[model samples]
Target: MSALTMPLAVRVIRAEHDALAAMLRTLPLLLAAQRLALVPPDFGALRAMLFYVDEFPERLHHKKESELLFPKLRALVPGLRGTLDDLEMDHAQGERAIRELQHSLLAWEQMGESRRDKFEQQLRVYSTRYLRHMKREETEILPHAVRHFSADDWAELDEAFGGHQDPLAPRAGQAVDEAYAPLRQRILAELPAPFGWGPALGA
Candidate 1:
């Protein structure tokens, strides 16, 4: 669908998904480069990126999907219950997963090189799962929503999804909120060109 014709909630969700996917793709590269250089991992930047995932996508984006979008879709489609259930399960597990990642990150930071492999492995698993989860939503779930949802449904979903801007992926012309400016900056600064808005890594 054209940008002007698409539902606001759909637009927001896709943009958020794109932003998140970029960050997920960047994490391993960032870690690998640091390791190759024999430089210390920038724990603060890594934390900020992960925290953004937790704070924005996990807390805000997925909550709206679970509470508003998924339930509504389930009611309308009925046939999609299985898929929706799986997505919801992913949502439920997301918090615990992020917390575990954070804990692994801390362990790696505190225990030195021996712990690095564990955190990297966990990150890989988490990223792959999340990427697949989003792919299902976009391909399986969202298309059904587009077909089934009424204008009223879009109205409600738009209100909920559009209420808050993602700090890392603000809409065009929307400035990053001050509260998240530092976190956003840290992430951009850490990630290289194409992956982030900031300068290239090592530049």
Candidate 2:
């Protein structure tokens, strides 16, 4: 699509959704690796990944939407109140869910393999909630904004989303969140090759 067609903010938001979806797809592998011991779970890598979930998407992305995008949209289209409220609730719940997952990660790391089932279940729940949340934003909210919001609105949204100064050096031409760089590296280094950054077993 042309630049005139898709607002930069929407593009950025969609990028985040895609990134989170990729991460969520890893959940099964992550949990299975932990449960079956097919490969030893790198609790440190797991923690780092979860920290990215909490810090970047949950905190930065959602905060931008809730604080800036949603409020502006609410004023532009009053009918969006219910959907906006639901989305906001999802954001809040996501924070709590991340905390639960963090706690589970710590417990498993420190105490051995006691709450594996609980951790897996919580991971699945959080993933499902997050996927659903993003789906709503994509299907219901973004299209509405594109339709109802003005050019000025789009400009402001793009500026707000794009203006954040990433605190880390750009890697592969894209800015990586500073805190997540190590986590990204760890995922590459520890996980199996092709899909993972690390070497394959018995290689």
Candidate 3:
């Protein structure tokens, strides 16, 4: 096949898709340090970071695809039947993970060091497991989607997501530069040397 021309939705989705993975890799380390190490975490900063990583980027960006992209794909490829069901279930599973970890986020953020340690352990395990789920969607599912979705389909999907409020928007003026600055730089640097839409993005 000729070089894949990513519609704007694909382009933005791919960025978010990889960005969430990159954040997942670092979050465990952040929690690990919060526990065994003596440094005190700024709950505000950590919460801000997670807001973007967990909610804004992944839940918002990827979920929009399920709401928007899958319907178009199903129209194009009847063989893709049940794909949306599986994708929706996967998203629910991810939300379940978030629900389970919700208390831990509060504990780590609100309580003192003692509670932080306990919360850290639980959060790390949950994050590591969640990363595996993300990998399945990115590799097994997203590439197959790119293969069949047309430029017009992608354009409509892009418009759909554009209207949705970004979950991280509330923190953009404050937490973005202070809390997530390092992470944003780290992700751009750590992306796989050969990365892009289609096969180049870890297909």
- Indicate which candidate wins on TM-score: 1
10 residues in a row with least lDDT, candidate 1 = 194-203
Question: What would the per-residue lDDT of candidate 1 be over residues 68-149, giving only the tens digit for each residue?
Answer: 9998888899999999989999999999999999999999989888999999999999999999999999999989988999
Pick the winner on lDDT between candidates 2 and 3. 2
Assess every candidate by TM-score. Answer: 0.96, 0.84, 0.66
Better of 1 and 3 by TM-score: 1
- Residue range 37-97, candidate 2, lDDT tens digits: 6556778778877887887788888999999889988998899899999999988888888
Off by over 4 Å in 2: 1-4, 165-172, 177-180, 190-203
Model 3 agreement with the true structure over 1-203: per-residue lDDT tens digits = 32256555555555555555555666555445544655565565555555555666557765676777766667766766775677667676766666656667787556655676566676677667657656666676667777887667666776865554432232223344455455554443433333211122222
Q: Considering only N, C-alpha and C atoms within 3 Å, which residue pairs clash in candidate 3?
A: none
Instruction: Report the alpha-carbon TM-score of model 3 versus the true structure.
Output: 0.66
Candidate 1 structure, TM-score to reference: 0.96
Deviation (Å) of 14 in candidate 1: 0.4
Alpha-carbon RMSD to native, per candidate:
1.4, 3.3, 8.0
Write down the lDDT that model 1 would get.
0.90
